[model samples]
Target chain A: QQPVQSPQAVILREGEDAVINCSSSKALYSVHWYRQKHGEAPVFLMILLKGGEQKGHDKISASFNEKKQQSSLYLTASQLSYSGTYFCPRRRNLEGSTLGRLYFGRGTQLTVWP
Target chain B: EPEVTQTPSHQVTQMGQEVILRCVPISNHLYFYWYRQILGQKVEFLVSFYNNEISEKSEIFDDQFSVERPDGSNFTLKIRSTKLEDSAMYFCASSRQGYTEAFFGQGTRLTVV
Candidate 1:
């Protein structure tokens, strides 16, 4: 099933923080995050595996709660460049080859203001 | 720093025409995927290919759509009969192995009239 992303849209001021959550109905092995600017391909951010593992890119971090079948992306001290749509993809059993392809969420749009 | 590359950034075709979108995934990647996003809509997965065969495909990937790995460096998505609804930004992605973090290409914008 497609994961559900919270806050269909958000407006943030520079230097603020925001959290985007992706929740799935089924158990998930990992959560992959990506940010896409207008008319551009989505850029990889980080991947959080099961067991509550967390990963990030510099200040953009994410957390995965395996028990809840959910993941959260945290943007700390948000910059203008952070403005984009965020999506999370879920997959089962991060063990072998199947770990690459992901089932994606609809995505959350974030707009940063000066 | 290798990235997925796609050709013909934008294409226009009339209904019933055939359109082929091309992509070259990262050299070391083993899994290839095709996804599409209509303007103002969410990205949807079309199919995933590995070992010269499809590993998985979504319902949206129907008889009208086909994929091929013509050579060592190229993967292609062919739409046999174009419909207005087929207009979208088609993205190609690849991962080092199956079920891993995917890297996407710039995308080919296909406009079917």
Candidate 2:
């Protein structure tokens, strides 16, 4: 099933902080985050796998809570480059699965301005 | 430093015509998939292929669509007959491992007229 992302859109000034959340009903082997700008393909950001796993890049970090089937992305002291749409992709635990395909959320649009 | 590559950044076709979107997945990857996203909708999985065969597909993957690994390096999605609704951005993704960290191509924007 497709995961649901909260806060369809957000606008912030540079140095501001924001959070985007994603929740899924099905179990997930991993949660992947991506950023997409207008008229462009999404770019990979980071992946959260193991339960309680926290992955970060610079000031962008995300947490995956396996028990709750949820994940949250935190943006600290946001920059203008952070302006884009954020999407979460998920898959069920690997185990014996083959050719795993990801289901993505509706996406959250975030804009940062100086 | 490897990444997926897609061809014909944009394609325009008429209704009932055939269209084929091409992709070159990352080298050494074992899984490949095709997905579509309307301008304002979420990305929807169409099919996943491995071992040169389809492993799974969603309901949206009707008989009209087919996928192929015709050579050692290319994967393609073909639609037998196009419809206006088929106009969307098609993405090709590959994962080094079957179930983790997928890399996505820039995507091919298909516009059906």
Note the Cα lDDT for every prediction shown: 0.89, 0.90
lDDT, candidate 2, B3-107, per-residue tens? 999998999999999999999999999899999999988788999999899999999999999999999999999999999999999999998777677788999
Docking model 2 quality class: medium
State which candidate has the highest DockQ: 2
* Residue-level error in angstroms, candidate 1, position B39: 1.1
lDDT for each residue of candidate 1 in A44-114, tens digit (9 for 90 to 100)? 88877666798877789989898888889999999999999999876654577553556766689999999
For model 1, the stretches where C-alpha displacement exceeds 4 angstroms are A97-100
Taken in order, the candidates have interface RMSDs of: 1.9, 1.5
Positional deviation of residue B68's Cα in model 2 after best superposition, in angstroms: 0.4
Residue-level lDDT of model 1, residues B8-113, one tens digit each, is: 8999999999999999999999899999999988888899998899988989999999999999999999999999999999999998877578899999999988
- Lowest-scoring 10 consecutive residues by lDDT in candidate 1 chain A? A92-101
Fraction of native contacts under 8 Å reproduced by each candidate? 0.63, 0.69
Instruction: State the TM-score of the second chain for every model.
Output: 0.98, 0.98
